[model samples]
Target: MNPVLHAAKLGVLRGWIEFKQMLKNPQEFGFNIIMTIVFLVVLYFQRNKTIEGNDMALAMFALPSLLGMLVVFGGFMGAATTLTFEREDGTLLRAKATPNGMVSYLISRIISVTTFSMVSVIMLLMPGLFLIKGLADTSWSGWLLLLLIFIIGILATLPWGAVVGSLVKSTASSFNLTMLPLGALTAISGIFYPITSLPDWLQVIGQIFPVYWLGLGMRAALLPETAVLAEIGESWRYFEMFGVLGIWTIAGFLIVPKILRRMARKESGSTMEKRKQEMMSRGY
Candidate 1:
């Protein structure tokens, strides 16, 4: 086998092992459960409410949008947090010491992050089917479209997450960097409500980010055609959704490698030790 392929295979195994470990960890497992519960609770409260212009249940409208938000949060925040924590703890330095280690490390991180995100999506979608109405009305084609949008959403966001992780100085800073902006974006991106209800300027700003397009794509998959009436231009605009997400995907792919390479190059034993000492001094 090619050396790189062999390394990637090992990385896959590593990612699987790490994912299992995460499942075993009480805090991590509890976090997943808590998140799923929170989503269900929020949707449950809105189950009886209907959108103003349409008879569709608001919970149904928000369900798919919430899924989009989960994808963005899982992919972006997961990648960013893992990178920052590992970097601080000298995992990057250990990878730097091995042959083809950076490649393996990157592969493993991607696998872990993708799998973790998908698990969260499934957790929300399964129970949500019973708790929320109108979600099961999709055809096979609609389901396929949802799957495609999901893959694209992950690709669009994960690399940028890596970029954010690489730029931040510490784990705390990385969390703040990714989450704060994402929270604000989610508010305006129509995850919880219709974008058409927001101010036009806010709608334009929301459209500029992947979160809005992700939510729109999800809504296009799950909602009835009439739901488009609540969207800008009274159309799903699949073309624009793909166009914006594709731009992010292309830009992230082009940029993440350079940033990762720079970050990896900066990893050394001395630096790791220094960071470790600082972490200890700070009582972290």
Candidate 2:
């Protein structure tokens, strides 16, 4: 079998095992499901509103952005939390001692987290299509567009999870810390609102990150063409989104491995012992 395929398959199998583990401990996934429902419900109520001549504008913007947000959030936070928890518990150290262990472990994490995100999207889509009449106009092409952006956006975000996972020392801290950036990303990403209405500086800041582009792609996927900015001279904005997301994906590929390797190199038995001791001292 091809090496990459072999590795990926192994990763996927490991992911399945991880999914079973997650199912056994349902709090996180449960919370995520509830949050998805809450968000969709909010949008459902707002379905009667109009924006820029489009009814159910908030749903159009929120649903796809929520898809990207949920996936990115799941990939980054899930990996970070799992990696940090394992490190604290010495699981990562044990894995590190195995041949090709680190690669397999990280790839497994990516697969598992990606799987979770896809599942979340699938669960959200049923009501998103049928119950949320706002999305009634969304077509097969929109779904395809969403899938493409999601795959790319998830790829762009997953490696950052690696870096975070390798660097963090505790699952507790990982859970809390990961939310800070993610919450900010969701807020500024134009998930619930239009980026155009944001202050100039914030819009610039939003442009600096992938969240905006992902949100824009999501908007493009779900919103009517007239609802988007498509002036003849400024038509490039839509094309620019793919370019921006692609650049981030490439940069993440190059940067994340180096950071993970460095983090791995910094790991030592003594460091693990110290972490264990610290956790014990904290009574966790």
Candidate 3:
């Protein structure tokens, strides 16, 4: 087998093992459960409420949007946290010492993060179907569109996550960097409400980010055509959604490699030991 292919295969296996181990870990499993429960509770409160000027239940309206947020949150935070923690623990240094190790590491992180995100989506979606209405009314085409948007959404967000992770110095810093901005974006992006309801300026800001576009694309895929009445311009704006997300996807692909390579180049035993000592000094 070609060396790169062999390394990729090993990475896939490693990722699968890590994912399984994560599922088995009580802390990680509980965290996923808690997140799902929180989502369900929010939907429960919105179950009887209907969107303004539309008969659609608020829960139903928010379902796909929540899925979009999950993609961004999962991919972004997952990558950021994993990379920061591993870098601190000298995982990157070890990989640097091995041939093609960076390639393998990158592939494994992608698989692990994507799998974790997808599982979170499924956990939320399954129960949400029973709790909410209208989601099950989609056609096969709608399902296919949802799948495509999901894949694109991951591609659009994951690389930026890597970029943020590479730039941050610690896990806490990574959380602060990703969560604060993401929380602000989620509010403006209308994950729980219609973006059309926000101020024009806020809507413009939201439109520039992947979270909003991802949610809009998911809404386009899952909601009925009449539901567009609640959207800005009363249209799905598929072209705009794809265009913005495509730009992000292109930029991320073009930029993440250089950043990762630079970060990798700086990883050495001395640096790792320094980081380790800092962690110990902080009692981490």
Candidate 4:
């Protein structure tokens, strides 16, 4: 097997272990499931009937965007939690002392979070599809497009999660900081409404990140072409979506590894010990 594959296999195993641990925590799992369902319900009901041609089935237009949002939330947040919590607990420090530890650890996290995000998509998504009405018209090609966008979207955002995981100093701080921007992004990214309905400035902001385009791409894949034009613009908007997301993915690849390296440099036994002591003193 290839070195990358071998390393990835180890990472997958590590991630699976962590994922199982997360599932065993009922409060967290319940919150995640409820959050996803609530959002799906809201988005589905709020869907524009005009876009679906007087049908509520038009909710398909929102699925891709919501999937993107949910995936990012789960994967990025899960990773952020893992890294910060591990750092606080000294696991990261211990791992760093092992040969190939850094590689194994990071890869494992990416795999694990990606898996969790994908599972969330299935659990939350399919029910919305069935409840929404006319979405049954989706061709195999449409499904293929959705799957492709999903995979690429996951890869594109995973790097940002790495950057976030590397940057946040602790679990509490990460939680407090993450919610606001992510929530704002959900609203502005056309996940619940048509991007064309947003202000020009907001549309510009949408273009600056992948979420908007990811939503647009999802709409393109699952909704009717005419419906998309009515909601966003022309069908050709997908090419633009492809272009914008592709650019960010490439840029993220360049920046994230450097950030990870710097973060790794800061991971020392003494620092971990000090953090643990601080947490212990604070009754954490």
lDDT of 2 by residue, 19-61 (tens): 7777567796788679877977887876666555345456655
Per-residue alpha-carbon lDDT of model 1 for 1-284, expressed as tens digits? 99899999999999988888887888987898998999899999999998889888889889999999989998899999999999988888889888999889998998888888889889999999888766777889889988998899999999999999998878999999999999999999999889889999999999999999999998899888988888889999999999999999999999999999999988888888887788789898
lDDT per residue as tens, model 3, 1-284: 99989889889988889898889988977898998999999999999999988888888889999999999998888988999999988888888788889888999998999888889989998998788877888888988988888889989999999999999889999999999999999999989999888999999999999999899888888888888898999989889989999999999999999999999989988888888888899999
Regions of candidate 1 where Cα sits further than 4 Å from its true position = none
Q: Model 1 has how many clashing residue pairs? A: 0
* Ten contiguous residues minimizing lDDT sum, candidate 1: 129-138
lDDT of 4 by residue, 222-269 (tens): 776656555554554766777877887788779888987787788887
> Which residue runs of candidate 2 sit more than 4 Å off their true CA positions?
1-8, 52-56, 134-137, 229-236
TM-score of each: 0.97, 0.89, 0.98, 0.89
Estimate the lDDT of model 1. 0.91
Clashing pairs in 4: none
Off by over 4 Å in 4: 1-6, 47-58
Task: Quantify all predictions' global Cα lDDT against the true fold.
Answer: 0.91, 0.75, 0.91, 0.73
- TM-score-best of 1 and 2: 1
Q: What is the number of backbone collisions in each predicted candidate, taken in the order shown?
A: 0, 0, 0, 0
